[model samples]
Target: MTDQPIRVLVCDDQELVRTGYVTIFSAQPDMEVVGEAANGLEAVHEATRLRPDAVVMDIRMPLLDGIEATRRLAGPQAADPPKILVVTTFNVDAYVYEAFRAGASGFLLKDAPPAQLVNGVRTVTGGEALLAPAVTRALIGHFAERLRPGDPSRTAREDIVRTLTPRELEVLEHIAQGLSNAEIATALFITPETVKTYVSRILAKLDLRDRVQAVVLAYRIGLAGGAA
Candidate 1:
């Protein structure tokens, strides 16, 4: 990693929750809590102003919601967006998917262990998607209907298929199935570094920002299906 500590912005409506997050993140030798926000509007404003390396966003907030705030900070229209790590209570599973669609790089349950929270920030900051396997399965299962074939993007899907080599396609399929680089390596009997290379090539060839989009593309193109 870089010598600079990762800058983090914590946003949560609950003061107690925000404090807890700050404490956990600030304790990391490689992290610095740059700012805090109690609502979506403040989150967007502070995140833009501070330009933190990563944002720990809450789903529910006053004024606006985390998803919209994330969109404002990191969506398709955004320029030089920072990585966003959405933290939420498991009760809001529906909103979690929307947060990802709005350009969040990763997410975690609010009740996850402190170490997981720390790792989530670092994962996003490193330009990696930080979805747990179970979360990935749930997300794909919840959105399966929206990913059916025969969409207007059929030609684009076909082009994507034609663009990737057979091995790259295999890597994409494993990624869509919520497999991490190491897991994919084991499954394919290749080294994890090799899997990483393939992942990079796949993203570059497909013009995807991260694994989240890769999973979405795999589903849309029939390379993956709802979790079994």
Candidate 2:
């Protein structure tokens, strides 16, 4: 919302892909391509130097992969991490999960169209999460594709729930179901602003970076399956 354009760092080893991203971002009035990196290590360095508002990260890169770079730049241990929107291939769902666990705010498939890609960067910077690519929505199954009952994260799941208020728990349920704030507001009969507030509180309470993590936690705890 500020007049200042969002500064962005584009990281991808593919020349045409990277150049396409730069061109798309360049055409946006509200976004500026601030830097570029061919691999994860350079991404870290440029991210450190440019300190961009968001990073358009590809999961595969030379020298270092995007997962490790995302971890170093957006990991829990990062002193002041920049928002990261991981761009990955649909076939490598494992990499997607690892990127999320590594602290990426959200992810888009490498094939996502320009608008969704741009929206992804905005979503992360807006302090919300982005996890949908139309083709990969059901492909990834809302972060539950790899999730099943009885994982180690299940133990932490209760701890995740214990940290939230009752209202926050409700918000988490809707988020896990892939409802937008407006939809959640409609379902809960509250204002969208209230839904947004509850979302912020939920993320803070769970020590999560965004709603994607919140949804993943919900499934991990069986909230979607009526066990939580």
Candidate 3:
């Protein structure tokens, strides 16, 4: 990480919530609140103009919702997208899943502690996906049909199997299961550094941006399941 404070943009439909987010982010010595938006349209405009390193996004707003805004700002076709951390009140909702598919890098509950919100900005800025385990399980369970075996995407699955080594495939499975690097190390009887290396290799070989996409790919190919 560089010595520069993270530049952040806060977006929410409620003025009070935006103010709280701005205050919290500004209080952190390593964070700078560059802008705030009361709706998704303004969010896209300000984010495009200011070009913050991270965006704290809300799910519901007039005119446009966070999911579409995230897609416009961070989707596959977006150029040099900023890291988007989606914050919502609903825990296990389809909107959150849509936001993830739209290229959000992290998810957090609105009731989460201020520290978690701060860390979420840092995590996304550092190029890591921050999904809570419970949320992951819920999403996987809700979307299992898209990930079930024999979904006529056999060629993609075959390509993944051919691209990754046996060990790398195992590491990918653990990642899909929501295991952290340290937890994966313990489970695989390897060092944490080794797990990190494997994760990097997986991302590079698959051309995925981060662990979130990796997990999605693993599930899509039937390499991982929605098991608790």
- Among these predictions, the greatest TM-score belongs to 1
Instruction: Please give the range of 10 consecutive residues that has the lowest summed lDDT in model 3.
Output: 144-153
| Model 2 lDDT at residue 191 | 100
Q: Which pairs of residues collide in model 1? A: none
TM-score of each: 0.95, 0.87, 0.93
| Overall lDDT per candidate, in order of appearance | 0.87, 0.82, 0.85
**1 or 3, which is superior by TM-score?**
1
Q: Candidate 1 on 155-202: residue-level lDDT in tens? A: 766788799998998999899888888889999999999999999999
Most lDDT-accurate candidate:
1
lDDT of 2 by residue, 83-146 (tens): 9988887677678777877888888877888998998888889887745634334533545644
Minimal lDDT window, size 10, model 1: 219-228
lDDT, model 2:
0.82
In terms of TM-score, how similar is model 2 to the real structure? 0.87
Best-to-worst lDDT order? 1, 3, 2
lDDT (Cα, tens digit) per residue for candidate 3, span 63-162: 8899999999999999999999999876436687678889999888899899989988988888768466666666567776655666455677889999
